[model samples]
Target: MPASIVEEFWRTQFATEPYRGGGFALTANPTLEEDRRAMLLVAADGTETAVVSPALAGVTATDAASFRAASAEAGARLHDPDLVHYLAADDRIGEETGHDIRLLTSADEDAFAAFEAGASEQDLDDAYVELDHWAVVGAFDGDELVCAASAYPWDDTQLADLGVLTLESHRGRGIARRVVRALAGEIIARGYEPQYRCQVDNAASIALARRAGFEVYGTWEPVSPDQ
Candidate 1:
């Protein structure tokens, strides 16, 4: 029941121009979108299904138990899952934070650069956060930026994709969650739903999403190419 709100929309989303998975259900999505060779979308309520390419459907399995084996045999190995999160319109938070989190612009280039310079290469790469995006926010300490988030359109849809990064030295203070809540409001104000995605094994990211009041919409992955 938790995913009832998304049923009609997600089915339509997959059936439209780009994806064209017209028959979205617990069964098959007849016409698979090229970009998404195969997808297993498990709704928040635990309802699960797969949208597999017609060419590969015969060998694919929809059940979680056999999905990995079938996908692996077809060259699209299913290893780690990708969790997708969404903030419902009613769940929007309007609370203010003690930290100095604000929307950023090109004028703050140097500050953003210094924040990046202070982070380790490995952490930055894994964070998948960038300074350039449709909407950027920063959490400041006095005048120094320690946490940042970038939001961009996802699949050119009404969903705004978001990524956040907090300096290793500045973590555990709830900066990421506060910054995300502030940004989600901005995304909705701009006429788009805020969407967050992260790998299943990423404990830190999962925690952040939970703390930010985001609900797990689905676990999606490509059947053939990590889809």
Candidate 2:
């Protein structure tokens, strides 16, 4: 695999080496606010780091267990970890699914709204793809938008994070594979790295990432939404 952009992105955030070279580094996350967010970032090399906001930084240490305990004490519970994948440029394997996936724009507003309206709330939240987002792409089923993808730069990094949604009635048709390939290719052509993230429990997303040429980079346990 090419050098992991995952490492490069987090490095600037920590203001120090986030990688422990197979160890742990519990550090304060400058970007987070107190009592707002706390979580863990595990690098591909087995390096674990407890990323807590500055306020809670004093309560944790270089121990992963202690970091978890501290986070719980701060009234924040660990959420489901997200499996992270970086697009493997040299290893990009392609497939032909007979879907004419293309880049979409604001002109496709009505179609995207109709597609979004057809998706359930759960699906909408899970996919997180939006038509008005930074970049949009999709495929049509005859005249209906059956599936779409969108991306945004991850933090301030060159990594373009990806989200893909397939119409509930149109999954299992290989639209996802083609859509992802098209979007990732677009991101690459724009001179940015592509990153795919999904909950570890999402079997379908995991499978699609692999088949679409994304390599597992690491797992991130970000703070759960405030409830």
Predicted structure with the largest TM-score when compared to the true one: 2
Model 2 has an lDDT value of: 0.79
TM-score, candidate number 1: 0.84
Q: Write one digit per residue (lDDT tens) for candidate 1, span 19-72.
A: 222323434456566656555666565665665666666764646546657766
Among residues 3 or more apart in sequence or in different chains, the pairs in candidate 2 whose N, CA or C atoms overlap within 3 Å are: none
* After superposition, candidate 2 runs with Cα above 4 Å error: 2-5, 18-21, 29-37, 75-77, 92-97
In model 1, what lDDT does residue 181 have?
A: 92
**Local distance difference test, each candidate:** 0.74, 0.79
Residue 37 C-alpha lDDT in model 1? 52
TM-score of each: 0.84, 0.85
lDDT of 2 by residue, 2-118 (tens): 445656776655556656678887666677744336777776777787776676656765666676677877777677788999876475535335776778988899998899899
RMSD of 1: 4.3
Off by over 4 Å in 1: 1-9, 13-26, 60-62, 224-227
Error of 1 at 45 (Å): 2.9
